[model samples]
Target: YAMTAAHKTLPLGTYVRVHNLENNRSLVVRINDRGPFVRGRIIDLSYTGAKDIGIVGPGTARVEVVALGRRDTSAAGSATTYIQDDYYSGNFTFQVGAFLDRENAERQKRELAKKYKNAHITVYDRGDKIFYRVRVGRFTTLEEAVQQEEILIQDGFPDAILVAE
Candidate 1:
């Protein structure tokens, strides 16, 4: 995996440099998903990332993790204590709008994606069928999402609301 994988401790959107300690290879990845959930894995890398570090075939390797800088608005504490206290916070994102018609949802998503790097649509079962939700950006803290919600409101997506992802 080239993009960074999940770490139980690192907050989402954290910029980190993962080093393949045994081979001395390194690559930077943005933490976007939660995982490795398996014990002993510190960070997961996307296929491209693992390939870059020469670990694709092996599927896993020892890596030295170094935070480039946490994009996480909340960095609780040292690596150890941080993981413990970290449960206090949750990952959040702003939903600018949702539409029953996939076309409308896709239109909004395309429009927003053109203007915002993190803009995308999430489809979920709202009732008997599915609904498309146009969401933009991820934040480690609810406050950040709220702030973005206000901006989206000002930008005319008045329905924007903060939601946990």
Candidate 2:
């Protein structure tokens, strides 16, 4: 069975379980699409399923996933969200940019702040390498991120990629 946490139409053959490492609770789920692409996130459960597994806030989690067989429509407890195709409808605002140097990232952040309203640089140290990420806006969906990337690309920031925050 396929397991995923993103928004896509699911076929009739996927099963997943979210096992919380902290609490040792598990919730069986169906695979509807491909997601939970956020760094360090194992699975993305629906709101109800997340509650059942006891994850409340918005952040990464340590969880184990066990793939079962195909999904049975006649199953007892299945979680579903009626998210329409246009569910990500919103004004695009956020743009995330990756940089190899801290000084260059800071310079870009200052420049963007002069043009736009909100621009910030987040620095992350991965082993001996440091990554500086410049993000704009408080977007709600990947579509919004893609829209903002278009705008940034027009402004000469071509290598930006969308990331969930």
Residues 75-97, candidate 1: write the lDDT tens digits. Answer: 66655212222423577776777
Q: What Cα-based lDDT does every candidate model obtain?
A: 0.72, 0.61
| Model 1 weakest 10-residue run by lDDT | 80-89
Best by TM-score: 1
Q: What's the TM-score of each model vs. the native?
A: 0.44, 0.41
What's model 2's lDDT at 35? 47
On lDDT, the leading prediction is 1
Cα RMSD, each candidate: 13.7, 12.7
